[model samples]
Target: MRGSGQIVNRRRMIAGAGAAVLGTLLPGGAGAGRATDNALLPKLTDGRHWRIGYAETMPYGNYAGTLASIVKGLDALSWLNGAARMPYDAGQTDSQALWRWLSAHDLGPRIRFVADGWYGGLDQAPAEPILQRLESGGDIDLMIVMGTIAGRKLAVDRHSVPTLVFSTTNAVAAGIVAAAEQSGRDHVWAHVDPQRYYRQLRIFHETFGFRRLGIAYENSPAGRAIASIADIEAMAGQLGYELVARHVQAPAGPDDQERYYADLAAAWSDLAQRVDAMYITFGRWSLDRFPALVRVFQERGIPTFSQLGPEEVAQGALMSVARGDFDGIGQFGASVIARLANGERLADMRQIYFDTPTIAWNLAVASRMGYRPAMSALLAADNIYTSLRAVP
Candidate 1:
C-alpha cells in the first residue's frame, strides 16, 4: 500500500499489483499491461497545460463531499506534478483546502476550469449545453462527469475526449460501462462505489437483528440508478429480512422542495409503523430533504442508516457506510487522469472503484433508539459521533 501523503505509482500499481485486488472485488480484470514502470508525473502536451472540464447533475445538492474529493484529487495531482507546496489545514473541507492551495500557489494560470454545468434536475438544464461546451472548444483534454445520470448520458454519447465518471453508483446498471473491468467506449472510464445498502443491511441485521428495514428513495434517474427497489428486494431476500420501501417522486423545482418533504414525512410515518429500522439511500431529492427526513426518523425512534457520506453520519444518522474519501478518491482519479494526459490509452487504464469505504456511527442516535452495536462493529467504524450536534 502507498504511504500517507505519498503519490501512488500508477504505472506499476495498475499494471498488475492493483489488478490482483481489483480482479476479486470487481467483475472482470484482464488485458492490462504488466510492466512495473516508475513514471508518476502526468505528461501534458507541450506548450498547453492539461484542461479538465467538469459537469455535475446537481452541483448544489449534497455534492459537497464529492466536490471536496475532486479538489483533493486535483491538489494531489498538482503536488505530484511539481507544483509549489501550500499550507495544509485539516479543519477545512477538501474544496476549501484546494482553493487555499490554489490561491497560495497562484496556479490559476496553469489549470483551466471549463463547462462547469449543473443539470439542476432531469429537465431543468438539459445536457445539450454541456455537450456544446465540450464540442465548441475542442481544447478540453479531459472531462469529469459528477453524477450517475449525467455520467450515463455522457458515456453513451459520442465524444473523443478521455472522460472520467466520478461518484456514480452502479455504473454498469446505469449503462456507464459494459462491466467493471471494461469500458464499452474506449474514451470513457468510471469510478463507481458499490451500493452501501447491501453491506449496511447486513451489518444492521448482525448488529440489531432487525427483520424489517425501511428505505426512502427518489424516483429520478439518479435516484433509481443509485439504489433500486429491485436490488433492495433481492438483498433483503438473501439476508432473510423484509423491506418496506417508500418511493418519493423527484422534485420538479424549488416550489416542490417543501412538498417533497411533506410526502417523505408521510412515508416515514408509514414506514415507522411497519419497519424496525430505516436505511436512507442517496438521491438528490432525498438528500436535499435529509434534515427533515432524519428528524422524522428520530421522532419515531427509528434507528436509521444512511449511505451518503461522513457528513451525514456526523449530522445524526445512527450509522452509515460513508463513501466519500475525497483526498483518496481525488488522488486515485488524478493519477489516472494524469496517466491519460501522458498519452496512456483509456483501454489500458482500468476502471476502478473507491474500495476504502468509511464506517460511521452516531452514538447519540444509537442510544436514543436503545441499540448497542457489537464491540467489533464499534471498533471497525472509521468515524463516530457522540452527540446530535453537528460537527463542523
Candidate 2:
C-alpha cells in the first residue's frame, strides 16, 4: 500500500511538472525545446486568438466537469483572465444548454469561443452539415470533443480541425485513435489511459475478493469499450471470480435517456439478486438517478464500485478512483492547447495521460455493506464521503 501510494505521488509530481513545462517530458513531445516565442505565448502564429469549438455525444456529468476543469485550467495558465467560469451545471442533461453556456461565457481575448462552432449534441443529424461547414469554411481552429461518439465524428482525417478529445472510456478501443502513443490522424489527439479500467478492477478485486462480480452496460462495440468489458473479463480470469453481466441499452437518441435509466435500474436490481458486487459502467444516466440504483446494491449489502470517478462515489458507490478537482488532466489539456497555439502538431505530441488514481470511498455505503476498511485503506483514500451527496 505504501509503495502504491508513493508511485501515485511521484506520477502526480511528474504530471504537474509536465503541465507547467508544456508536456516537455511526455513522449513524442516535438514542440519542446523550440525557440522561445514569447510574442505568441498565448496567441496563434498569425497573431490572433485561437478560435475554439466544442462538441459532445450527449450531456453527461463527467463531460461538464471536465470542461469546467479545462476552462479553469486555461485561466490558470493565463489564457483567460481568471474571471470565466463554466455556466452549465454538472448535473445538466441538456446539451443545447451547454452549447448556449459555452457560447455565452466570457472566455477572454486569448480565445475566441466560436459561438456557432457547437455541433453534435443529442441529435447528430445536424452535425454533418455543421462539420462540413467547419471542414470547408475553416472557421473552427480547434475542437474540444468530449465523448467517444463526438471524437469518432470530429477527429477523423476528413476533418481538418485539430481535435482534443476527453471523457472517453477508451479512445483506442473506440476507434478514436490509433493507439496511446499516437493518433493516426495529424489533426487528432485524445487523452488515453489504456490500463485505467484494468487498474480500477484490480483495486476493486483486491479490496473485496468478491466471488461473483456483476456489471451493466450496453452490449455493442461502443458499449463494450465504455465498460472495458475485455479488461473486466481478463481480470475475472486472473482473479478467479465469476463475471455476471446484464445488457442495458445505451442512449442512441435524445429521448432515450429515461428509458436507458429504467433499463439500468432493472439491470441493477437483477444483478443485486445474483452477484456479490456491482461495477457501474459509464452511462448517460443523470447522477441524480444513481441513488435509487445504488439503493438496490445497499439493500442486498453488495459492494459497488463506480467505473467513472469520485463524483459517482460521492453520489452512492462504495469506492472508485478519484479525480480530485481534475487539475492534472485539465492542465495537461491546457498545455496541449497552448502548444497548438504556439505551432505544435497535435499528432506529434503524446496523447497518453493517466490520472494518478486515489481511492474515493463512501463510508456510509461501506457501512451499509458492513465493510470495515483497514487503517491503510482509510489513510489512502483522498476523498471520503461520510454520506451520499445531494445530486442536483
Candidate 3:
C-alpha cells in the first residue's frame, strides 16, 4: 500500500501534468457519453491567436469571470499550437463592438468570431440577409451554434463554414448530428447533457428518495426541443424515477409576467400530487419568470432543479446546470472556433458544457417546507456552494 505522503505527492504530480497538457488534444478528445482521459485535455498557450464569443453571460461568470476563464482557456488552447486568442463579447449586439474589440488581434493568424448564439438561441430566423451574413464566410474559419442553432433550420445551403455546437440534449433530433455521439457530415460536437442532468437527478433521488420527478417546459419549439431528448427518459428509467412532463403554452399580452407565474404555480400544484421532485427549464426565451417560481416550489415540499439560468440560482436555488461557464466558455469555445479558423472543419467540431462550481441552497427554504437534506449526503457532494442554515 502507498503511504499518505506518497499519495499526496502523486496527486500533485498529476495536477502539474494536467496543467502541462492544456492546449494539445489528449489521447482521446471529448466525445458524447465517452469516458474522458484525465491525462489528455489539451494545454493552454500553444501560441495560436484567435477570436471567440459567448452568447450568454450570467452564471458563466459576469463579464470579468468570463474573460478570465477565456484567457486561461486560451493559455491552455495555445500551449502546443503556439496560439494566442482575440476574444469578443457575445453579449454585445453592435458590429462596431465586434470590430473594435477584435481589430487589434485579427492582424496575425486570425480566428474571428463570425457569430455565436446566446445559449445557442439565434437572434433571428434562418432567412437572408441573416442567412446571407452567415453564408458569406470571409477570413472567418468556424461557425458555432448551440442547441437550436444547428437544427434543420440552418441547413438552407450547402456550405463549408466548419461548425461546432455545445450543450445540446437533442442534437440528433435537431439534425445537428447523425446520432448521439457521431457527426452528421464533417461535423463534430462536445455536449454536457449526456451525464450532467442524470447526475443531478440521481443526487435528488438519494436525498429525497423520490421515485418520480416532474419536469415542466413551455409549450414552444424550444420546450418541445428538450422534451424530445431520449437520454432523459433512459436515465429516469435507470434511476427508477419517473418523469411527469407538462406543456403550458407561452403566455401572451403585456402582463405576460403575471400570466407566466400563474401558469407555473398551477403546474407545480398539480405536480406535487404525483412527483417526488420538480424540474423546470425556463428563462428569457421561455418565460423569464423567476422569484415567483422559487416561491411555488417552496410553498410545496417538492425539491426542484433545472437549467434555471445562473442569475436565478445565484439568488438562491439548490442547483442549476447550463451551457456556458460565462468566463471559461469563451476560452474553450474560442479554441474550438480557432481550430476552424486554422483549417479545422466546422462540420467536425461541437460545443461542450462545463460544470458549475457553486451550489446555492438555502437551509431556510428547506425548513419552511419541512425537510432537511442529509448531512452525510451534502458533505459527500461534489461541491457545496451555499449556506442556508447554521449548525446549532
Candidate 4:
C-alpha cells in the first residue's frame, strides 16, 4: 500500500517537433561530475541552475515508493553536490501546480523543473508549453524519462535540447539508439544486463525445480527491459522448463482487478498440467497484484518466484532477485542530467544503475503452499519476512 505522504507528479506532450523546439528553448544544459567530486569544485563544466524534466511511468506497481526515494536523493544531491536548482514543488502533482508553487518560491538559479509526464492525462503535458517556456525563458537542460512512456520512438535533435533516456530496458532494443554503447548524440539508455534476469531464474530453479514458468508482463518497454523472458529464453531452455509468458494489458477498470486475479489463476490453473510451479513477473500489473497471486499460488499448490526487488519481498513476494535501489537510480539520474545541464556533449558517457539483489522469504507463504524446500534451504533462508497469513 502507498503511504499517506507518498506524492506524485506528471505532465503531457502533443506534437513531437513542437516539443523539440520547446525543449531547445529551455536550458537543456547543465554541469555534473562524478559522485566523488567535491561539492565546491566543478569537475566537468561549470553550469549554474539545472533545467530538468522527469518522466516516470508505471507508478502504480510497487513503484510509488521508488519515486519518493528519488525525491529524497535529488534533494541530497542538491545540497552535497553544489548542484543546480531543480524545477517544481516538492510534492505537487502537476506542472501547473508546480509552476504555481515555483512562482512565489525561492528555489534560486540552482533549480529548474519541467514536470513529471506520468501523472497527467494523455496529451495533456503539451510540449509547446515547455518549448515556449524555453523560448520565452526556459532553463531546463535535460529531461530524465523512466521507461519509454513516450510511446513512439524519439531521436536526438541536436538543434533542440537533448534528452537523456533512463528507460529501464536496454535502449538498443527499443531502437532508441544504434547500440548500447551509443544512443543518439543526446540520448543513451542505461544498460541492464540480460544476464541479471538469468541469475534470478537460476535462483528460482534452486527453489522450484524449474517446472513450467508462468510469467506476466505489461506491454511497456520499461517492464520488458527488466526481463523480456524472450531475450533470455535460453535461461529457461537451460533449466528445461516450459515457458508460458502472458502479455497482460492494463486492467480496464477497478473491477478488472478481479479479472487480473482470474487471469493469473488461469495462467497457472490451465497450465498446471504442464507446469508444477510458476514464476510471476515483476511487470507493473503482476507486481502490483502480488498478494492476490500469492493467494492463488497457495490455492493451486504451486510455488511462486519473483525477482523484482526488496519492497516486494516485504509484501510477501516469494523472492525478488534483481538490484533496484531508487536512491541509487535517482542519484545516477541527477548526476547525469546535471552533467547534461552543464553542456556536456552526452557522447559515450557510461550507463549506470545500482544492482544489489536482496532476498526476502515469506515463511508462512512457503508453509501454506506446501513449499517445504530442503531443510538446508530453510535454514539458509535470509530475512524470513512474515505475512498476515504466515504461520505464527
lDDT of model 1 at residue 261? 72
Off by over 4 Å in 2: 1-45, 72-80, 83-110, 123-126, 254-258, 388-392
What's the lDDT for residue 313 in model 2?
A: 77
Tens-place lDDT per residue, model 2, 312-362, is 776788888765445567766777788787777878877777654567678
TM-score of each: 0.76, 0.79, 0.64, 0.66
- As for TM-score, the candidate ahead, 1 or 3, is 1
Model 4 Cα lDDT, one tens digit per residue, 169-244: 4455555555554554554444333345665677677666766777666656645644454554777778887777
Report RMSD (Å) for each prediction in the order shown.
7.4, 7.1, 9.4, 11.9
Pairs clashing within candidate 2: none
**TM-score of the candidate numbered 2?**
0.79
Cα lDDT of all candidates, in order? 0.60, 0.72, 0.46, 0.48
Candidate 4, residue 121: lDDT: 25
Alpha-carbon runs more than 4 Å astray in model 1: 1-36, 59-111, 114-124, 194-197, 219-222, 228-230, 285-289, 323-325, 389-392
TM-score of model number 1: 0.76
| Candidate closer to the true structure by TM-score (higher is better), 1 or 4 | 1
